[model samples]
Target: MAVEGGMKCVKFLVFFFNFIFWVCGVALIAIGIYVQVALGKALVVSGGSSAGTPVAILVLGVIIFFISFFGCCGAWKESYCMVTTFAVLLSIIFLVEIAAAIAGYVFKDKVRSVLKEGLQEAMNKYEEDPTLTEALDELQRKFKCCGANNYTDWANIKQFQANDTVPRSCCRINTTTCNVHPSPETVYEEGCQESIEAWMKKNILIVAAVALGIAFFEILGIIFACCLMRGIRSGYEVM
Candidate 1:
């Protein structure tokens, strides 16, 4: 009777964990979409290779969303075959998440150079491309930064070389004189690259926390699923 009771508890625990996984899937999807949009905007001014991460996250979330349903049905029906399949799929996802975490860590170091190159390219073509001009202006305004390295960096822009003027977005105070006659007191001294890097570090920590928390729950779900799979196979009458 005690063993039967334990199996019954495992059955419900698997169901409960599957529900949690479903909720997590929804959360991941929401986060993925938010990050994807944010990155899309930023990449307009500072193109980089990190665009794949959010898309991968979105795809993984969709997969998890569907797989959780499968797991829920397996648990409720006490089907050994279905439960085993769920366990296998969950394990694969767990491995993929770990690999993604490692890849993110590796890519973190290259962001600075990527941002510098992209910003420089955007600046050189700022006058030629209205889209780049608008995006770069928004980036500068948002970051409260002037140029790739500093305000002086804008002096090298081909279109601005004649007048030696920077964009109004580089002004610390948006006065007419600030752009026409930029000086240390009138323009932002800080570089966009530094400001953007700081912003990314701050947000990456939040992403890391969410990823770790989800990973913990995923581990729990896998363990419970395995337990339930064994119970079902052993003819413990989990139903």
Candidate 2:
């Protein structure tokens, strides 16, 4: 009677919130994706990244916000099917993202700094003796990696190290270069920093995939609850 009607009313509210939560989740992911695209090619990041960091933070934040949103909806809907789905999704995303944020906030920065230092050194060296092409040639034997002709190829340093034996000379960009890190007399201490940054980057993507899984389930559980109740006739009618 009164209790039955009250319970149905609660479920209706729960369903509404569940839909809203999923919508938010979708928005966050969309924004995050946009941020990633914009930041990927940023060249002159005065503060580090032209845009990626803030977007990443926003993405994680939105994901977390929606997780709670859907969880609440599931609980209100009074369906373990929904609650369990939401909980599992939340738990997995929480664990993985926390791990990634810790890793990214820690080790990845180190790689970026080192790579920048190395590139700075290379840039200086190039300016000093751009005409002294032979000096550039000698640079090949010094640092065993491939790079763009007159600039630092910080992006592809890993390929050089991918062997049982280290490269005997700079990886030939075409047929001209043997010297490496011909920037300045600083930065290029030993290895390129891109290696660490690239390695960590792959892991960060994994975190996002886990988060997406959670968001997907958030939508699923609510619809399940709706279906569960929809066919039940009226609770007052009884089975």
Candidate 3:
């Protein structure tokens, strides 16, 4: 009877963990979509190689979402085969996530170069492409920054060269003179590259924390699924 009770407990744990997994899958999907949309905007402006990150996240989220549903079904039915399969799939996903985390850490250094190149391309094409122009202006206003490096960087752009003016987005205040005759006090002196890099670095910790938390829950779910699989295989009276 104790053995049966223990098996029942394990079964309950498996079901509970699967529920958490389902919620986590939903959260991941939402976060992935948000990141994809945000990156899409940046990619349109910069034309960088960052399209993969969000897509991978989105794919992983979908996979997890489906896997969690399978796990829940396995737990509810107390099916040894299904529970074992869920454990195996979860383990594989965990490993993939680990590899992704390592790759992200290793490639983090490339962010600066990508940002630099993209910002420069946008600035150079500012006059030729209306989309690029709007993107650059939005970037400047969002980051409270002026140009790729500084307000002086605008001097190199042909369109701005004629009027000797920066975009109105660079202004600290809404004034015509701020664009035509920008001074350190009237315009953002910081560069978009620096501002954006700083913002990313600051938010990276939050992202890491969330990832770690999710990983912990995934490990727990795998363990509970394995236990339930063993119980079901032993023909334990968990019901």
Candidate 4:
């Protein structure tokens, strides 16, 4: 009776942990998609070598979602094979996430260069691609920034003449009436690279915090799953 009671407790704990794990996987996927589409695509179009950090997170989230199902079903059914598979898969994912986190931190300094180059590339074709145009406009407006270096950087674009005005995105206040004329005193003198770098740094810290929290929960899940599997084996041996 005591063994049966212990097994029941183990099952409940494993199920509960897996359920939360599954939900977190889903949340990660959602956030990953948002980051990739909203933030990554812009940089990719600009000349970034990779689709950026969001793509990695998206892939990890997908893998986690599938593996979490194994854990959920295994715990619910008390299946040894499924539970073992879940543990192995979890271990692999844990290692991959750790590696990815480390890589992101190590390469952090290069991130600004990538973003700067990409933003510059986008500025050249901003008029040609409506999507790029809107994205750049939104970025500049939101950050209250101008070109990669400053307002005059727009003057160097081959597509524009020596004296062509910058995009209205560089304006201190964007409106239909806002002047995009090349006037140093009228527009936002701040550059976008600094703002983008700052934003990336803040987001990196946030993602790290979230990853650490999920990792803590996953450790608990692995422990409960192993315990439940042992209990199941013991019960069978007794019978």
Q: Is candidate 3 or candidate 4 better by TM-score?
A: 3
Better of 1 and 2 by TM-score: 1
lDDT (Cα, tens digit) per residue for candidate 2, span 1-239 = 76566556545655555565566566567656755553332222212443356476566657656665766655565555665666566556656766865786687566476455544444334435443223333433333323333224533344333332122234433333323334333223243334324444755686567555655554455454454354333333211
Clashing residue pairs, backbone N/CA/C < 3 A, model 3: none
How would the candidate models be sorted by TM-score, starting from the highest? 1, 3, 4, 2
The C-alpha TM-scores of every prediction are: 0.91, 0.35, 0.90, 0.83
Cα distance off (Å), candidate 1, residue 28: 1.9
Model 1 residue 59 distance off true place after TM-score fit, in angstroms: 2.3
Give the RMSD in angstroms, all C-alphas superposed, for model 2.
Answer: 13.1
Kindly indicate the candidate among 1 and 3 with the higher lDDT: 1
Quick one: RMSD of model 1? 1.9
What residue pairs are clashing in model 1? none
- Residue-pair clashes per candidate, as listed? 0, 16, 0, 0
Write down the RMSD of all candidates, one decimal each: 1.9, 13.1, 2.0, 3.0
> For model 1, how does the per-residue alpha-carbon lDDT over 136-228 read when each residue is reduced to its tens digit?
888888888898989999888777778989999998886778887678899988988888888778898787887787788889988998988
Cα deviation of 58, candidate 3, in Å: 3.4
